[model samples]
Structure formats: C-alpha cells, structure tokens
Target: MIFRQIKLPPMLGYLLIGMAIGPHALGVIPSSEEASHLAEFGVVFLMFTLGLEFNLAKLSAMRHIVLGLGLAQVLSMLALVGSAALLLGLSWQVGLALGAAMAMSSTAMVSKLLTDRNELQTPHGQNAFGILLFQDLAVVPFLIMIPVLGQPAEQLTSSLGFAALKIIVVLTLLLWLGQKLMRPWFNLVARQHSSELFMLNILLITLGIAWLTELAGLSLALGAFLAGMLIAETEYRYQVEDDIRPFRDLLLGLFFVIVGMNLNFAILLDQWPLICVLVLILGPIKVMIITALARLFGNSAGAAWRTGFALGQGGEFAFVLLALAAGEQIIPPAINQSTVAAIIVSMLITPFLIQHSDKLVLRLASSEWMNLATNLHQIAVRSMANTGHVILCGYGRSGQSLGRILHSEHINFFALDLDPEKVREAGAAGESVVYGDAAKREVLIAAGLMRARALIVTYAETHSAMKILEMVHQIRPELPVIVRTQDDSDIDLLKNAGAAEVVAEIMEGSLMLASHTMMLLGVPLNKVVRRIREVREARYQLIRGFYRGTHEESDESDRQQPRLHSVQLTQNAHAIGYQIGELGLNELHIEVRSIRRKNQPSIQPDEQFQLQNGDVIVLLGVPENLAAAEMLLLQGNR
Candidate 1:
C-alpha cells in the first residue's frame, strides 16, 4: 500500500519493508539466515515459471533480439563492469564475480513495469525482455563459474573444463528425460481429477528437477527452469501456470524480504560516499552501453534510450552473486556490502528512469539524435492521414478475410500488426497493412484510429484484446469495435470491456453450418440470409439483456425467458465432486445442454458425469433459476 501510494514498484516496497523490519533495524525478523533459506525457493519457483512461459515459437520470432542483442549486452557489461571493479583494486575473481552479477538486469521488474505501461511489445520493451531472457539463460554458466573463480590457480583450468563437460552432459540428459517423461507424467496426474494432486505433482516436478540439477553440480534454480521449459512444450502449460502462481508469488515476496534483510546499514553508512559515487557512475554508464548496443542492433534512439533506462540497474541476481562470492571468500565483507548497497540503490532508481524515459530522451538526445528513420516515419504519417477507414488490429486469417472483403467492396481500410513478416508480405502485394502494435496508443494513432470508421480485433490473446479495447476507448469511445474470440465465454466480457460486438467463431461457424444445410435443403438465398440475420439478432439481444442485467423477463415475451448461462468450475467448487444428475440442476429448472472441457465440447453429456476443475457447463433456464444454479456451482458441495 505504501508503494502503491507513492507509485513505486512493489519490488522496492518489498525491499523497504524487509529492511525496516529486519535484524539491522527493528529486529522483527532478526535472523536473515533463516529468511534466506526459506526464500531460496523463490528463485527456484521464479525460474520455473519463467521456463513455463517459454515459447519455442515466440523465442524463434525474437531470435535476433534474444540471442544476438542479448548476447552482446551480457558480454559487454561483463567486460566493462569487470574492468571497472579491477580498477577499484579488487582481485580478478572478485571483479569477475561483480561483473557477472551486474551483467543481469531484472527480468521480472522490467517486464512488469513495461506491461503495466502497455509497452512490452514496443521495440524497446521487446529488446529489453530479450536481453533479460538471455541473461536468465546465462545464469547457469555464471553459477558454475562462481566456484571456479574461488579456486586456486592450479585447479582453475581443470575446474573450468570439468564444469563445461558436466553442464553438457546434464543438459543433454535433462532434455532427453524431459522428452521421455514430462507430458505422460502430467497427463496421468491430471486424470486423477484432484486439484491438490495436480498441484503436488507440479511441485514434485519442480523440486525433483531442482534436486537433480543440484546433484549434478548445477544450481537448483537451473533445474527448476529446465523443468518449466520442458512443461512449456506441452498442452498443459497455461493450467500449470495458473495452479502454481500463488506459491511462486508468496515465495518470491519472501525472497525479496531476504534481499532487503541482507542490506548492511553499518557498511552502507560507512561507505555512503562510495556507494553514491558508484550508483551515479554505474547507472549512466550502463545506460550508455545498453543504449549503444540497442542502437547498434537497429533500435531507434528513442527505443534505445527507453531500453537502456528500463534496464539501468544491477539486478536481483547481483545480490545472489554477491552473497555467493562473500561465502566463497572471493570478495571481502566490506566490498560485498558496498556492492550490495550500490546494486540495491541502482535498482531503486531504475523505475524512476523507466517512468520518465521520454523526458530523459528529450533532455539528453538532440533533435537529430532522436534517430527517427525517415521512411518509416513518413509512411506512418501518411497512414495517419487516412480517414473513414476501418482499422483492423490483426493480420491473420480472420483479419485477411475481412481485408479482402473490404477491398472487393472498394471500402477504405488499414490493417496493423506487430508481425513484420506479415506486414512485409502484405505490403509487397500492395495491401494497406503496416507493422505496429494496436495496444500502443501511439501506434493506434499512427494507424488513424481517431478517424477510423471501425476497429476490429482478431487477436487470439485475450489480455492483448482487452488492452486494445481499453486503449481504443480512451482514445475514441464512440468508435465501433468488433472483437473475435475462440469461444462464446468471452462475448459478454468483451462487450463489457467496450467492444461494440464480440464474434465467437464457434457460434458463428455453427450458424454458418446451419445456413449451408438449409440452403442445401432448397432454401432460397434471400430467405437464408434473412434467417441468418434473425439468428444473429436473437443472440445479440440475449447478450444485450445479459449485460444490462435485464434477463428476468423479455419485453416481447412478457414472461421469464430461458437464458444461456455458462458456469465455469473453480477449484473445489460445489459441482466438482457431484455428478450432474446428483447435483439436481433439474430441481432449479436449469438444463445442462453441454459441457466444454479444454476447448472440446460434449453436447448433452451423461447425467452421471462428474465435472473437473475448469469445466464450463452450458445451462439454459430462467434468470433467477440460472442464478441459483450458478450459486450452487460457486458454493460447491457446502
């Protein structure tokens, strides 16, 4: 709450609270050692989740930034920061330790901030994430090198060579084992229909892998990360993320608390001047280096500065490295304390730098240094001049179909997408499409959002679709917006979110199928069109009634109308244990017409069927009766 009030990131708040309540201060949590042991899982869980969010497809898409620019940033930071530490009279090992630590930027912090600001897909934000991802992947080797750095001259080469060979063998074995066992193991656990069991299985997977990795002379965190990556390849990734999130968050908070407790106030007070000097020097120097690297990789100056400022901090990993170095006697307590203080201070300032990145660019970069590419800017400006055109917010199948129809009808339309390949291909064929993210207000404006007749979102990501809705409403509230969804469940949500219309492909495709069948039965074209329109109108009216809270009775019917109710099963909900027949939905006059599990539908399912968590039951009944059914679903067997 304090951080929220001050508009600071929660990470800083966690750090502050930990510091204030810690042994060095109030002594509420006097034993930092105890906290550290407990908080270690925070890193383990964090790495696990990071791996779970892995996308082979997305990683491929971001290969250049994640691998190329990311590699460049890490190597450069290690060289520069390590050199600086050496200049400060630190031993080579100590310098290397500090360098490796400082080379990482906070993935969680930067990604969270950029996501909140709706900039994660912007050129800068993407670049920053890519670099952070690489840094995360780099942690494994860095951990291996830590003990090597602590070794004497005689054992250095042997230690390095042995570590390399061990890493290769471990990685290959982990991958092979994961491919053989991961999906099958999870599938068996899922069939048990117990959320607790599912969660436990996940914990086992995480800790088991972590244990294996530690046993193989690698970090426990790396093992957890590999577990997550293996899971990411399967179909259960989203559910795993949802199920494990609470544990991850609580442990992560504890981790931050441990970090805060590690701050030595006595050392900080004694080395205040040095700490200040280092923070000041490090922030700007890191920014310059990161900015230069970003620009070298084709990011414009604006994007480069934004990326630099967003990541101008010694990251969370720095604390881990310093603690390890201190333990290994690679760095003295005094140097460790000072480096920790400097790192924390830098972290404290990163949010401020990112928040005011625009002003920073304006202040530091000259007009010419803004580095706006002439052709892209001119093209964007020209696109912005378009009026009364439809703005299509995706370039996939649905969007392309819409565009073709618009073209055939000689209607003005412009499509925007972040997929450079799609935009390039379409533009080569003289299509009015451009590369841009619609979730960015600037990008929307550049796509002529203000003067557009309508906005259509065909993106599959619900979060992205919702974000675009909010952005569009903020800019043009009255503009017509039609959003496409994979299921009917999001229809009411999308509409409530300010989408003028929500098109669920499943429902519409069914309607299309029915229409084709009718035509095949010798129905006239005009009659078929009229029937389709009537069906659409009826669905829209029902949706309108649902949103307006007027489903008790219809004006035309003058009686309670049967309304569609979708009840999603939450963990341990009342309906989960009982079979449909046993629950007695019939008592509430709620007919269970169908059930949707994992995108597959079971129409008029067996009455004796038990429901799993996440099952969406389709009910048709009067409003008050459906409400009772919903209440039962939510209330569970209690």
Candidate 2:
C-alpha cells in the first residue's frame, strides 16, 4: 500500500515487505531458510512458464531482434562491464560474474510496465521484449557457466567445453521429446475428461523437466524452459499458461521476497556511496549498450532510446548470479552485498524510466520522429479495415480456428489479439491480425466494427468478454454476437449482456458425446442432430440472476428463462461418488432438473442414481440456492 505514494514497481514493494520482515530487520521471518527454500520453486515454475511462452515460430520471426540484437546487448554489456570490473581490481572470475549480472534485465518488469502503458505493440516495446526473450534463454548458459567459473582454474577448460556440449544436447533432446513424447502424453491427459488430471499432467511436465535439467548438471530453469517450448508447440500452450500462472506468480513473489531478505538495510546504508556508484555505473552502461544495439539493428533513434529506458534495470537474474557468485566464493561477500544493493536500486528506478521514456527520448530525437510514429499507427489502422468483415476478438487457438473456418467460406475477418508475438507472426504470414486490446471501444472501431458482418469473441476470461459484449451493444446493438466460454456457468450472464449466441464449452462437449453415442447405437444422424439442438434449446436462456448485473432486462426480441445453471462436477469434488437421493437436494433448497454423464442425458435424474466425476448437473433454483447447490455439489455435503 505504501507503494501507491512511492510510485515504485509492485515488485520493489514485494522486496521491501521481505526486507522489513526479514531476519536482518523485524526478525518476523527470522530464519529465512524455509522461505528461501520454498522460493526456489518459484524460479523453477517461472522458468517453466517462460519456456512455454517461448514459441519457436515466434522467436524465429523476431530472429533479428532475438538473436542479433539480444545477443549483441548481452555480449557487449558483459564484455565491457567485465573489462571495467577487471580494471577496478577484481579477479577475472569476479569480473566475469559482475559483467554477467550487469548484462541481465528484468523481463517481468519491463514487459508488464510496457503493457500497462499500452506500448507493447509499439516498435520500441517489441524490441525491448525481444531482447528480454534472448536474455531469458541466455540465463541457462549463464547458470551453467556460473558454477564452472567457481571451479578451480585447472578444471575450467574441460568444464566449459562439457557445459557447451550439454546445452546443445539438452536442446536437441527437448526438441525430439516434444515431437515424440510430450504431445501424445498431453493428448492422453486431455482425453481423460479430468481437469485435475490435466492440471496434474501440466505440473508433472513442468517440474519433471525442470528436475531433469538439474540432474543433467544444468539449471532447473533450463529444463523448465525446454518443457514450456515443447508445450508451446501443442494446442494447449495458452491453457497451460493459464493453469500455471497463479502458481508461478505466487512462488515468484516468494522468490522475490527471499531475494529482498538478502538485502541488509544496515549494509546498504554503510555502503551507500559504493551502492550509488555501482548503480550509476551499471544503469547507463547497460542502457547505452542496449540502445546502441537497437539502433545498430535498424531501430529509429527514438525507438532505440525507448528500448534502452525500458531495459535499463538489472534483471532478477542479476540477483541469481550475484548469489551464486557469493556462495561459490567467486565474488567476495562484500562485493555481492553491495552489488545486489545496486541491482535492486536499479530495478527500483526502471518503472519510472519506462513511464517517462517518450519524454526522455523526445529530448534526444526531434518531434518529427513522433510524427512518423503517428503516421505508422494511422497506416496500421487503415490496413486493419475491410467493410463487411467480421471482428474477431482474440487470436489465440479459438480465434485462429474461427478465422480459418471463416476464410474457408470466404468471409472477411480481422483478428485482434493482445499477444504481440502472435500478432507479429500472423501479420508475417499475411493474416489480417491487429495487435491491440479488443475490450476497448477504440480498438473495436479500428477493426471496422461498424461495417463488420458480425462479432465473434473467442477470448477467455469472462470479465473481458462482458466488456467487449457491452461495447458491441453500445456501438451497434443489432450486430450478432457469438462468444465462447469455458463453461455454462457464465452463459446466462453473457446472454443477459446481449450476446446472441453463448457457447458453453462443457455443455457442448457433453452434447457432442451424447450425439456420437446415439449414432453408434443405430440412431439416425438427423435424429441425433435434432436431440442435440433440443438440449441447447432447453437451457438456451443460460444462467440468469446468478449475478446482480445479470438481472437487467434485455430489449432483444427473445425472452428466454434466466435461472437455469449447468454445473459440472470435478474429479475431487466433494459430491463425487454420491447419489442425488443421498445429498438431500430438497433440504438444500435446490433442484437437479437433469444430469449428463458420458454420452447420456437423464431428465430429472432418479434419486437412486449415483453421481460420478465430470457429471454435468443441470440445477434450477433461486440465485442463492443455486450458489449453495453448486458449492454443495463441488464440495460434497460440505
């Protein structure tokens, strides 16, 4: 909360929390051992997720920035910074450690800050992210080398060569495993119809791969990265990202807090002059190197400087290198303590630098550069337009699938996605995809919403979907809107918000299962189709009164019932393996109108019927009872 007035990054605030409660300060978390141990998993999960996001196709597209500029930035900063440290009276090993630490920049901080500023799609922002991508991948080798650097001088040559070979071998093996093993395994997990199993599989792949790399004498981060890359090649990349993000972020915060606990306030004060000197030395050197690399690689002067400002901070990896160096005795404890303070302080100032980048760069480049950027944005807007085209929000798997179908039928549609990498790849492949948030009315208009044939929202996340729906209603009320949802729980909410068609994934999957079963049982295809349509027609009104806002009346012609809910039972749900008659639904004040299991629908399922996991129970009750019933069903008599 104090960060609100300070205007510092939340990460820095997290660090402060750690520092204040740490052994060195309040002694609230006196030992710090357990916290640090748990926090180690944070680095593991983070690297795993990073690997998942490292789409080979996307990186290959930004090859110049990723390989050329990113490589240059790291190498140059390391070389120059290392040389400077050597001249400053440090041993070669310590100098190398110092240089490696200085070469790093925070991916999480820079990307997130740029996104908040809505500059992620801008040239400079993309350049910054691309450079960060390389830095992230480079950390594996850095991790490998750090330990080797700590070894005796006689062993350095052989260890270095072995490390290089392992990196190549590990990467090649990951590629092979991704193609031959990971894909099939994930497919099996997905087919199990168990969300828990699916999530478990995700965890296994992540931590298991991370462990494999650690066993191979490489960093756990490297293994996790490879695992993520393997998953990225599959259709489940985004879902995997969503499933693991909360765990990753939580553990990552723990990791950062541990890092903060290492910062002794007394030491920081005692070495204030030295800390300030190091920060002053590191920030500009890193920035100048990055800016020079960006400009040399064809970025405009303003863009180059903006890129510099975005990445000026010493990254989280700097802390990793510093800690390892200290532990290995490659760098003196005093040096690590002071250098860590400098790195933390550098990170502390990055957000301010990024927020004020344009203002800072304007002083460096004339106003004409800004004008040119504006013209480019205008050109981009013009290119996104095509009258009568459908406006497709989100270009993830669902959106891309929809676009392909639309294209097959010769329907013009432009894709809008927030992921810049996806946007760049789509654009390169001659797909009509725009990089922007579709939840914004301006972004919608830019995609030619007014002249569009219809709107299809394939984005995940209910809140953003609702916002897009509301905006669409406000802009052109008559435009047919179809939205995809993860489940039936939000159907009524979306329907009430003016969605013409709300596809509930769980219910639809159940319907498909039922339909296929009927056909195999000698039922005619026409009969199967009619039955499936009838099921949708039955609960077509979706959930109503579940949310207060959903109680609003719709002016649309169709007046469907609003209080029905289709809730699915997860594997570990409390009510799983219990019968409807046993649960005493009447006492709970809820009614199970129907139940869907395997490939069959039971209308007003018999009280004697047993409940299994993954049963889609259609409940009808008042909002309060429905909520209680859902809780009861999932929790099993709790």
What local lDDT does model 2 show for residue 287? 81
Off by over 4 Å in 2: 1-8, 168-178, 367-638
* Clashes found in each candidate (C-alpha, N, C closer than 3 A): 2, 6
The C-alpha RMSD of each candidate to the native structure, in angstroms, is: 15.0, 14.9
Instruction: Go through the candidates in order and give each one's C-alpha lDDT.
Output: 0.78, 0.77
RMSD of 1: 15.0
Q: Which residue pairs come into collision in candidate 1?
A: 574-636, 574-637
Q: Estimate each model's TM-score.
A: 0.68, 0.60
Model 2 TM-score relative to the real fold: 0.60
Predicted structure with the largest lDDT when compared to the true one: 1
